[model samples]
Each structure stands twice: as structure tokens, then as C-alpha cells.
Target: MRDPAANNGRELARSPREPPSVNCRLEGDPTPMQVAKRYRDATPESDRLPAKKARLLSTNTQQLGTENETQTKKTTLQQPEPRRSKRSYASFLDDFADEALVHRRPELLCTFVSEWLESVESDREKHCRSDSHLHPSDEQPVARLRTRSAPVMVKARDIGGFTVPPTPSSTGPPSFRADLDDDRSRSSSSSTANVRNPRYRQNNLRFNCIHVRHATSPLPVTLSGHVDSLRAQRSSPGLSSDDLNQAMYRIDVLAEGCDEEQVVKLLDDTVFPDPEGDDTFGPATGLMSNSSTLMAQHLVPADGASPYRVTQPKPDRLYGYSERTVGGAFTQSQLLAQTMLHDRNPDYTTATSRGLRFPFLAIQFKAVGGTRGDLWVAANQCAAASSACLNAVHQLNISLQACQSTRRVDNLSYCIAVDNKLAELYISWREDSSNYYLQQVDTFVLSRPVEFQSFRTQVRNILDWGKDARLTQIGDALDVILEENRKNAAQAAKSRTSPPDDPAASAKRQKPSSRRNSKGSQSSQTQICATNPTLPEAEAG
Candidate 1:
């Protein structure tokens, strides 16, 4: 040995590092020895890393191929094709290795990369050309300049229609190193870029029909019966008009002004008294000064206070006790129809959208049909005075109850009848508070009728027929029709002015008439002017 380390160092210093030796540059059909020598001289240490990586990748590929084969056999549909073979792992690495050699040798690199790029572009173009899922015409790049992060959260969803939660403002988007994250979001966004897809039109059409009806039309309705009392366990004998006033019920006859001694004397004479004292009602004051503060208010047998049911033996003239009063209770409701909303700024669909709210709560008189106006004063009064609660919710329950009574309309888009048999007297609230709200109530169901449908159809037809429809489709159709009409009118005017004695021109002219149907065939409504076949043949004549 001749001091090897020192000799190697001297050799390295002598070469001036030769730009790290363009690693393993392939010569024209170079032999293995030449290639190996090139690799070694290119720098032994640098070669070790790539060699190790190559071994690892090769081992992984072999293992992946084996497992894939096993899986292919295990799967039925008699077995899936092995993915690793399809992947062409060895071939892929071969290309990469070839490219590295080319880079070092210049001449080879250009040819290999060009071939690879061509294959990639061809595959990509094929995919792009076949795929209609994306709307390139509408696929304008998203304006990244806008930020709606702080907008109020209404509702949003992914392409699958599943709801996604809003992201936190503080956490921010993913880290810079997150490579797949950007691609994932981009893919998700691209999939939904076609905002005018037919699905959008369908969804908008539904909302259009529903919202417009609710906003413009009235709802269906029904009322619950008073027969609930008959089936109820508790027996409330029901109230008379006077019983409705709770104020007058608890009063007792007494002196003008109440004093302390008078109150004591009344308590002693009347209700809860000493064993030796009398019970009575009299002027009260002092401790009993509170309006409801009567002491031991006495009760007598109640012939005077109880509702006089003369039937079953209250032979004695009883007085001084009271019974709780009973009042009636019931429910009522209204159901609004669905409708399309208006659109000043056109949306993705032909139909517009608007939300229907509560309808005009008016009074209808069954006996006097036209008398009831769309006023709320009388209805509100009835709503208040009737046993039924006057809230929209309570009214809804009443309508449901009323619906249960019959089987005519089940979907309940918009309808209701107010034929509550037990309803003693119905009153509707007045819309105007300036006047007293005392109007008789009638049964009126506020739903869109057939005429309403015809109106909507006519509007849609007009939109389709006229250029003023402001839609591309409708405008084109209109232009064609107008052009044809103008031509026809001009020809008709020319025919009227033609010289009367022009025999040839007259002979050439044809009269227009309605079309005729042939045997077992439907006739076309329109007809072209043609000469009659019934005319005598010139030679025969």
C-alpha cells in the first residue's frame, strides 16, 4: 500500500472536480463495462443513493405485483385484473432511467421526453373531448378576487347535495406544503361549475311554482267541531252570556263604605267563623282593604248563585254558593298555495320564484255571498271571541281538524271550508280599526282556481310567442313567425292591386282555403294555395 488516502486526495485535487462528471452518459450502444466505468467515475458516493432508491422501488414493485395478482384471483367476476401489471412499474422506471441518461448525454433526452409528452397529451385530449360534464361555455374561471367569507350562513351543499359546514375564519386554508389539498378543492369546484345544468332548472321550477302561489294566492282551511265536549271526561255545563263576565260574579250586598269593624262583623256573621259566631257578607276595610281581601266570605245554599236547573229537586230556596262558569273552545286554520316568484334579474331558469306568506284573512257570508269583503276586522273579532285561539298556528290545527272530517282534497295545496256545524255565531275581524269590527263570517276557501291556471298558461304562451319575452329561445321563434307574416301580408296586398285583365297572371294565381281531412287521417290546420284537381282537363274539353 502506498498511503492510499493521501493518493486519492491528490488525485481528486488534480482533476479540479470536473463539474461532478455528467453521471453515466450513454455512448452509442455502449458496452456494460463502459457504462459501469462511467457511473463509477461520475462519483462513487453520488451513485450509491440512486442505486439504493432503485433497489427499494424495485422491491416494492415486485411485492405490489404479487399482492395484486393474489387479489385478482380472490375477487370474483372471476377475479379482477392485477393493477400493478396495468401500472407497468418496471416500464415506468425504465423510462425515468432512460431520461436521466439522456439528460447527461443531450441527444437522447429530447426524443424520449417528446414521445412521453405526446402520449400524455393524446390521452388528456381524448378525455376532454368526450366529457360533457363540464360546461366550457359557462366555465369561466372563478373570480378569486371576491371574498364572501363573512356573509351570513344560509345553507350550502356539495355537488352530491350533502351539506358542508362553514370553515372557521381563524384557522385559514391548508399549509403551503399540502399538495393534494389544492387539487381536491379545485376538482370539487370544477364539478359544480355548470350552474345552469338541467338540475338547476328543475329545482328552480319547483321553487318558482311554490313561492309564487304562496305570495299571491290564498290558502286552504278547515275548522274543528264543538262536539269535543261530548266526548271529554270533564263535564263543563257551558256558559250563558252573563256568565262570561267574571267581574259581577263575586259581589255581595253590603253597606256603602267599608270600615275595619264592619269587615270583622261580616266575617263573624258569614263564612269560616267562631263556633259561636254567625257567618255573613258586609262592609270590609282595614286588613280586608285589598280588592280580593274579604275575610271568611260566607256561602249559603246557592239557589241564587247556581244556574237554575229546575229538573232534579232543589225544593229548598238555597242561596250564597257559586259554581265555576264554563266557556266553549275550538280551532281554525288556513293553508296557502305554492307559486312562482318574480325575477327582475333573470335567474338560471325560465320560471321565476317568490315565497308565499299568509293570505288575505277575510270574512265570507254564506247566506249573503257578496256582502263579505276582504276585511279582517270582523274575522279578528270572531277569532278573539270564539273559543278557538286566534294565532296562525291555532288556525292551522283547526284547518287540519276540518280536513279530517271529509276526504275530498288530501295534498292540501290550497283549500278550506268553514262549515263548523256547532259554531253558534261566526264573526270575522275587520281590516279597518277606524270602524267597529262586527261582520258576520262566511265560509271561503282561498285557493287558486282553474281560471287562475288558464291565466298563468296564457302568460307563459304569450312569453313564448312574443319577442318581448326577453329570452334567446322565445325571441328566435318570434322573429321567424313575424318574418313569415310580413311576407304573406305583402303578397296579399300585391295580389289585390294586380291588373284585372292579365289572364296569364290570373291563371297562375291560386285561392287559399282551409285544409280538408282525408279518410282516416287528421287534417293539417294550415294549407298552401294550389290549383283544384276538379277543373276539366284542357285536352278533354
Candidate 2:
């Protein structure tokens, strides 16, 4: 305290411009030590927004990456797996069994197995090494032993006295040596082996024999009393020819095989019974007598002993109306055997046929009833006509070539539907193309109570159109098709034989044209010079 202010003033005077020390403090401000203590105390409480935001962003980025990876994994799982090749061989066998089952012939399985085994053996033989220890002669004894058990072997011995020879000494075991004869004997044995080893030939012959026997066997006649029953039905009072025609159509549609009596009985029981009325065609003796009398008059031949043949009935005569005339007797199938369709058994198995061939034409008469009837039913009739037409075309194509001469075979089909008041005729034929397609040629309608004469005229017009117009059109179309095919074949052959285009040759050809064009331009310039003498020489050039 001895003069302290004066001492501080003396220190300041000594260094007037000297800066203050870092730890020095102003009068009103806190001291440097106090500020440092304050900063240290508040450090833990300071905001850290940037760091927090960075952490949140990093976590979101990681979550997005994980989600992307999960999405990629899900996409991979959604795809269908590729097919394996190992199952193809099993599928082929399954297909083979299915096809064999379709034929209803289990023997086909044996045939397929035999063929497969033969093919496998052939392939094995082809791939086998020639120098291998397995000698071809070693397998002969097994084959010979197999063939000797066959029934054909007995027949072969009786026919040719063919016998299997012993194995050559070279191929036999070392202990069992056999002497060889002349070369002729070896040649004879080789030839015999070649001829006798093919056991399939014998099997084929046996199969053919069975097929021939089955085909030639006559179908049993089951319509012994069919005529009698039909006659009985015809004599029923109030029954018209239309009813009779309907009955015949029903019979034709339902009958299968030669069982006409059964068909008639079924029709009587199911279709023809008049449920609404008491008067029905049931099995009655009185009706049979009347039917027999009617049968003797019309259906039966003049000679009662001759077998009755079914014929189309003549049109009924109307009072005060003249009779209509039609040309040619129209024949319809009254029995299954007479129809053009293939015969089938009750099981739907196709019956074997003899060599006899039926005609190509098939006609069905359908009766329309009520007001418009079903449009779908009418459409089906068209389809039926088309099918019949195509079947005829196929048969013709197989049996005969297109008539090279003027005798054109008209393959047309017709389905006629008639009601009490209206009649419709549908005509169909095959159109020309790479494949035959059915086409409706025309549809004709006639008012009900139509005269037979008008019907005949319309039919004759259709026949004429088919014979003259349609046939000629088809032939012309066929000719055009054949010509186009010939042209295509020629073009194909020319393309196959022609040389490839050469760029150098094409350039050479272009050069000549370019020279000619230059010459043409030069001539034109000279002509201009002659016409305009005052023109400059450079301009003319």
C-alpha cells in the first residue's frame, strides 16, 4: 500500500503501447479464467443438429438399400421354373401307350415293343466295335433257338426243309471244333438266315389273314319281320305319307347294323307312340292283318314270293289338283346296310367291310314343324349336308382321279326339309383350294302343299347346275391351281439352279448404261449448237 497507484502508473509509462496479455480482462468484462470456465460448463448443452440429421439420413439410406435387396429377391422368386429335359423320355412313353390304347388293340403294344427292340439291337450292332470279343456268330444260336419255337418254323421246314446250321469252328469254343464244308454250304446258310430271321413277315401275314376273314364275313340279317311291322304301321287310319316319311327318316337316323326289327320296335316304343291319343301303333293282331293286306298291295313285289324292297312312296293326290310328275325314282336308306355312312356296332366300333363300295350320294329328309322351328337345328342341317359333301369328295379323291375327260363326277350333297306348308332344300359342295372346304351352293324354298312337278323341276335345275356350271367351275379352278403349283415349282427350281448375283458384274452392267447416257448428252449438245448458231461454244459443250 506504499504508493501502489504511482507504481502501476510508472509501469504503464514504461511500456505505453504494449498490448494486453491473453489472460488480461477489461474492467466490466469477466476475467479470461472465468470465460474459460463458463464455456467448459455449457459445452454438453450445445445443439448438434447437423450430426443428428446425418445419423438419420444414414439410417434411412441403409433401410432403402435393404428394401431394394428384398424387392430384388421377391422378383427373383416370382419367375416360373424352367422345364427339365429328363422327363421327356417318360412323356414319350406315356404318349406311345395312350396312342396304342386308342386303337383298342393290345397286340399293337407287342408290335411296338418288338419294333423298338429290333431298332435298339440294330443300333447296338452299328455302334459295336468290329474287333470286340463278342462275335456276331455267337448271337445266331439264341436267335435260331427263338425262331425254332415259332409255329411258322414247322411250316418253313415242310416248305423248304430250312435248318439252322452249327456255328463255325473259328467262332466256337476252343474245345469244340467243327469242320467246314465247301463255300456253297456257307453261302446257302447265310441266305437262309437272311430269309428266316425276319419273323415280322410271318406276323404280318397272320394279321392280314385275320383281317381278310373278318372283312369277308357276312353281317347277320336281323330284319326278318321289319317289312311286316312297317306294313302294319302304314295301314293305321289317319296316317299320311308325311307321317310315313317321318317314320322312315327316324328309322334311317337311329338304325345301326342289320337289326331293322329292333329299330322298328324301338321307334314304336319311344318315338312314334301317340301319348296324347288312345289310337296308338301298339302290338295288336287286328292291326297286323290290315298291315299284311296293305303290304301285299304296294310294298311287296308283284310276285309275293320275292323279298320286299323298300321304295319311296308316290306323292298323295289332292282333290281338284292335278298330279305332279318327277323324274327318276329317289331312293333313301331304309336299312343300315343300305346307307352310305360307315357301319358301327352297338359299342361304336367300326364294322369291317367287304370289297363292295357304295355310291357317293347321301340324302336325308328332315321334316320341319310349327312356325320357325329352331334356327340352330336348321344350321345343323347345313353342317350335316356339308359333312356329307366332304365325305363324298374324300371318297372320290381316294377312289378316282379327277376326270381327265368330259365325264365330270358331280360330288354334291342335299338335305331337304319339308313341312305341311313349306319345303327347304340345302345344297353343299367342296370349294377349290389347297384343301377342300365345304361351301353352300344354294338354298331353295317351296311353299307348303307344293306339287311334285315343281319340286322335280327345282331339283333338276340343281342337278343341271352341279353337272354343267359347278363341275366346270371346279375343273377350271383346279386347272388354275395346278398351273399355279407348276409355276411355283418352276420358280423354285430356277432359283435353286440360278447363280448368285455378283456385285462386280452389276457394276460392269451399270458402266455401259452410264456411257450410253454420256453419249446421249453429247448428241443433245451438238443438236443444240446446230439449232442455235449464236450460242457460246462453252455453253453448247
Q: Pick the candidate with the highest TM-score.
A: 2
How much RMSD separates candidate 2 from the native structure?
43.5
TM-score of each: 0.15, 0.21
Q: Report the lDDT tens digits of candidate 2 across residue range 1-541.
A: 2354564454356422222212233444542323444544566744635865686689899999999998888877343457865322233353344421324345544554555455444544542354244445554432324544555433222234454464453866554443334455654553332212343123322221211112123322322131122223222233356754564455454432223244325333322232123243112201110110111111111222322211211111000000111211111111121122222321111111111111111222323333334323333333322332344334334222432324334544443433322334443334341222222222333221224324434433433334344444434433443444456679899989997899999999899999999999999989989999999998886
218-261: candidate 1 lDDT, tens digit per residue: 32233112112112332212223343222122112222333333
Candidate lDDT values, in order: 0.28, 0.35
Error of 2 at 4 (Å): 99
Quote the positional error of residue 364 for candidate 2 in Å. 1.6
Candidate 1 residues lying further than 4 Å off, grouped into runs, are 1-82, 85-92, 95-105, 118-122, 125-387, 390-541
- Alpha-carbon runs more than 4 Å astray in model 2: 1-362, 366-379, 387-414, 418-423, 427-450, 504-541
lDDT, candidate 1, equals 0.28
What are the clash counts of all predictions, listed in order? 44, 1
What C-alpha root-mean-square deviation, in Å, does candidate 1 show against the real structure?
34.8
